[model samples]
Target: MNAPTASHHLLPQVQARDVPKALLDALQARFGAQFSAAMAVREQHGRDESAFDIPPPAAVVFAQNTQDVSDAVKLAAQYLVPVIPFGVGSSLEGHLLAVQGGISLDVSRMDAVLSINAEDLTVTVQPGVTRKALNEAVKSSGLFFPIDPGADATIGGMSATRASGTNAVRYGTMRENVLALEVVTASGEVIRTGTRAKKSSAGYDLTRLLVGSEGTLGVMTEITVKLYPLPEAVMAATCSFPTLADAVNTTIQIIQMGVPIARCELLDENTIRMVNAHSKLSLPESSMLLFEFHGSPDGVKEQVAVVQEIAGEHGAAAFAWAETPEERTRLWTARHNAYFAGVQSRPGCKAITTDACVPISHLADALLDSVTEAQEAGLPYFMVGHVGDGNFHMGYLIDPTKPEERELAETLNHQLVERALKLGGTCTGEHGVGLHKQGFLVEETGNGAVEMMRTIKRALDPHNILNPGKIFSL
Candidate 1:
């Protein structure tokens, strides 16, 4: 295998795992119309946004509920076939790729907001409910879910990756918000982990273990997550800095001062240009920091004053505010569209993205070094970051036809991950270790730790069937 990270990045050495005719027949007979063997449907479930082009799964099972998911898994388990649970398919890493042939268990239809406990500030939702949908469901209650991974990622998918996004600075990621899950084990048995209670000393903490397990452990059917009362006041601002360092430094200072800023994001000039062109906005073309403050009216004002003062000290041009709800929505929508903008900037190119997160104290150094390396590599690229927490992603757009370019991007990514590890940070912050970062996992967490992970995988999925060949090889 030519180091499978993205789909195109890996020149395959292994053939698709064999899927027996008997298993397909049984699935079709049991699921009836829910089962599909069409090439288009299989292809759609087989790959994610990653540049990988693995062969499509042999079939797809459109699961409608917990019973559907359980039955599908049981059938696949009978033949020791790999089962990949797919949500919105918005993952950047190769999380959805079926490197070993089997069946894709798509759960998009299982979307349901099971309950909204506004008084307790919690909500129960099915695995396929998208983030935007969840927010809309609880909007009337004056409570909102905070995790937004840009894409309208499903709650289940977010849980699998332990995803965090813009609001992570204040509200935290999936691991912090997710309280309970109903999961289907590899043997097709259903199990519930965690409770709606805020705290529990209840043994193994299986909730945390499965939160970021990346689907190698089990498939989550229902998710119960924490919610926060909507802030009395919300403020969004964009500050352009003279240089990228200035913006990164401003972010570092803001965090160090202990500001409970809701969201702090960084976008380089190139990314700004791309988003400007794609989103039809007239944002300034310079290194910029996007900040959002959520608190009482006076509290938001105080935060704005402190942040503006810090930005002024770091050579900020001017602070622009999106005061109205519509304006704020448009601005944030554009920001979330940055990835599409970058990919479109280089037509027919694959973005080999990096997710290296370091400590807050080393944010500036880590981000700057990675940017410099990308520039030196001479690739069409753009940069965006959740810098308040020292996590950033650099997208290196490369022509898949040019193997050399792909290799160059991989080298840059490897170097960046190595540097971040030296900084005592993770190789991946939000994006889970799909097929791409397995080596980096070993480097970051040592052989012993990874071996323990394998031990867990073997324990949960002895046949090596659940999302096989992902996170790490068994």
Candidate 2:
């Protein structure tokens, strides 16, 4: 891998004045109805799941295939317009924002499960297919795709964000599962990286370089992901602890013992209260750990016994097990809806979530200290995590209309990032450095690394047309 030398250059920024009538005329002539002036509806494709509302794109192109993307990119390049690729629009860090007002290239129309190679246990999919949709398609095949981000986010966006979820502890993140990618480079050239050989010492590892690039380097048109066989026997259980530390300690023990646990999640007392109120489930108002075990019948039984003993040692109470499939589904549904529940607890409040990951041994201490800080500041927050992987989310409810409240929340969010860095963790665990964490990224990676990233960005996108003002500033 060759790293470019840092050179200072003034990158061009797109504005309303830069809208080329020639480009629009060309787009209309080429795409007909697929390209229209109505695409100038910046509100539709500009912002994402972030708290800040950025400037939207000057146009939105509904691409149906790789050729469509290439055409759009070529036209944008000719007009010097920034192009931003959009997926399900569920990005938490404003990855979809078209700040410079160019084109928002939407690929949802290209969604399709292209092929399923059952023999090799891999699947090829168009970028627009969501994780839930893929799982539904593969359900009957007795296989499953496990990179879940709690949102039914598009595979393209998931790969771009390097997303992970509850099952990541056992299955791994997009970085681990994505075997290959068919990408459209900044120059509108199509290329494929990686193969289905299961392992390789391939040059440069372009698959990974683009996986978390957040559309800065290229546009992902298709993804090849590794799949896993569905577990034969599964068991899920919930245990309440006298304190958050107790619950986290038990989770630490379970992981250290290598219990083969599929998912181990922690919900602080505040989060549990919110879940009970919103989901209408009667759960004890104490910190809880939701766990799932997967393996053969005997293996699951043995693992469950070991986990139970560890929980008992940590003084875990209300150790209820959900053995049936229906019960397990309901339990997980409740857990997945926890973020929504947290917001519903406050009728007029919007959620601003902050995620950070650390070493497993430090997770409990980090979580406990975070809760204490939030309480001392008199902020309303809920906590939940995929504990086995040491990733968690803190949901803060804020009055968006109040500037003071928003500023306070921002301060707390920055503090959280600083704390994570201090504890030797990335500013973000799953979410990429879209627009939210660029400052923290500078702090985390420092000037030298960021300079290297900028050099790569300039090398791949000299015209600054691909996702301008994201990950790195011009």
Candidate 3:
């Protein structure tokens, strides 16, 4: 067996438990084909995109609906076994790892578009529905969900992580867009939070609480999200700058001027080089910014002019725009696949991703200092960010076979996160505190707030059977 990877940096002493036969027999009898103890299934459900190496779950339960999730939780609670909710497994913070032996409740099969109220600009969907699938389902209605987290991530996973992307600056992230959710609690009780009409002062704000809880408190079954009408005219563009500082300055000025650009992404020279090689494009090997403007023709043109003026002042060169939909898709697709491109740049290398956010005023200093530190440490890393919102990601490529390389990567991440916090930022901007940033959460929020979170977790899941040992341990 492999040594289980715990996100806390310290190797947790979690022994594999002897799963009770009664619970297994009951699950197999009641759920029939929906339950499986196969090693292959368990292993698949145990892993995520994070670099952590963890033990597989004892079994995998395919939940097809909210009731299935509730029942599975009921059984797990009865046996006092951890229940780890599995989505598409795209999480980078070790959210899906079954560190302690338990059952993986996969909700990918629960994909269903429950309803779409075009007039209300809202869509209700099952936890399994991916972002692209939801857009395709409602494309004809001229409405789309703007919370694109690069991956074709499931809606449930995005909500659970409170994911955001390039468009977050203009529209919003899962935290802002999710209006309601039907969640199954630790005790197998189904509860609804928020409402369709929006703006509710009803009791506790359970919806927001569970949105980024990382399935540690409850399993979200149904998610109601806000949607935006598709823009009449959309334009995509890319600009090259002489230096990273120039690119960062241009982004800062653009945001400061209140440009209503839909998407603004910053890619450092190394990331651009990797992307060009992976995407087979001749983009300049220089610090670059990718942007998209969404609005009427006049509105987009006005936004573009304001952005161009700012870029020009910062020594931007080779300004280009994608006029056709095909061209626009190709440009954004390359941006979306940046993580893969960075990984593929070094074969057999794993990416230790960093998610840090600061106030707009501190983004440049925080980003520049972090970049300087990584480069000085002699580690290979790629940079990309939704600079419009002061949230960015760094994918530090490391050869997993080399322990020294992992150590260096961790060192760089620690320094980067420390700088962000010092600048009044967060340890994680979008990626939830699954396992990776548990210690940093304490540093960022102080002991009192973290203790409050633990208190809430204990109150909700008294048995500690809901994804135990993640976010924070009791």
For residues 1-474, what per-residue lDDT tens digits would candidate 2 score against the true structure? 111112111122435437788888887788887875674455778777677666667777888999999989988888888889998788887788877777889887779999999889999999999999999988889999977778888999999989999999998899999999999988889999998879889689999999999999999998999988999998999999999999888988888888889999999999999999888899898999999998999999999889989999999885798999899988888998898898888888877778889888888777788888778878798889998988888888888888777666667777777778888988889987887777778879999999999999999899988888888786
Instruction: Please report how far candidate 3 places residue 64 from its true position, in Å.
Output: 0.8
Assess each prediction's global lDDT (C-alpha) against the native.
0.91, 0.84, 0.90
Candidate 2 off by > 4 Å: 1-17, 39-41
Candidate 2 TM-score to native: 0.94
* TM-scores of all candidate predictions against the true structure: 0.97, 0.94, 0.97
lDDT ranking, best first? 1, 3, 2
lDDT of 1 by residue, 1-474 (tens): 134355323533656678999999999999999999999999888778888778899999999999999999999999989999999899988898889889999999999999999988999999999999999999999999999889999999999999999999998999999999999999999999999999999899999999999898999999999999999999999999999999999999999999999999999998999999999999999999999999999999999999999999999988899989998999999999999999999899998887878999998878999899888878889999999899999889999999899888888887788788888899999988897888778878889999999999999999988988888876
Q: In candidate 2, how many Å is residue 225 off?
A: 0.2
* Clashing residue pairs, backbone N/CA/C < 3 A, model 2: none
For candidate 2, the per-residue lDDT at 352 reads 77
For model 1, the stretches where C-alpha displacement exceeds 4 angstroms are: 1-13
